[model samples]
Target: MPEHSDLGLLVLPEAVCLAEALCDLDWRRYVAMVELNFDLTQFYDHVAHRLGQPRMFARSIAWNRDGDPLRRWVMAHCGRHKQTRNQYWDRVRRHQLPLVHSGR
Candidate 1:
């Protein structure tokens, strides 16, 4: 991951919401949107429109580095990690297994 000097640009709560919304999109739609947008500005505009936040723009909440905290959070919370974690919890519940947090 690349370092970011402007780590504070994105608001955590808003970025989390955006990540969740992205995760909720069907794979095809996600791909289509990515294909259509030429840049992050256009992408953000489409996302903001979908999210009904017309005022939201890339400038207000942008990630300038590969190691942006928002990017890390989205990766951990929105994709394969989320799917696997959900599957694990579902199986645990089905088996009536007790959950033990290791406090990572």
Candidate 2:
């Protein structure tokens, strides 16, 4: 099987919640570490619900000569900063926060 990118693993609803929790624990200090952080349970719940809808996760091509809409949706609408996963995890490890249970 092809390996999935960290963003491929995390851009969905369930994983985004954990990202939010990390941010909340640090009071926005780690905002640069993640692309998006959502603290509101209601909003997150809405996202989870929407993702469950039929055809919601379907892949399609971008028209209208625009750039990557998926990136815009994930970064802009989701309020995430654009950073590589390595940079994110490195910062998290350097912080030495107790929230992470699996980091080296």
RMSD, every candidate, angstroms: 16.8, 18.7
lDDT of 2 by residue, 1-104 (tens): 65876555336674665455434534233434443334323333433444553322223211212544432444453344444555766787789967657777
Residue pairs clashing in model 2 are 35-80, 36-80
Which structure among the candidates has the greatest lDDT?
Answer: 1
lDDT of 1: 0.51
Each model's lDDT: 0.51, 0.43
Tens-digit per-residue lDDT, 15-100, candidate 1: 67666656765632443333212333554555566566764444343444555553344344435344555676577677996668
* TM accuracy, model 1: 0.27
- Report the Cα lDDT for residue 20, model 1: 65
User: On a 0 to 1 TM-score scale, where does candidate 2 land against the true structure?
Assistant: 0.23
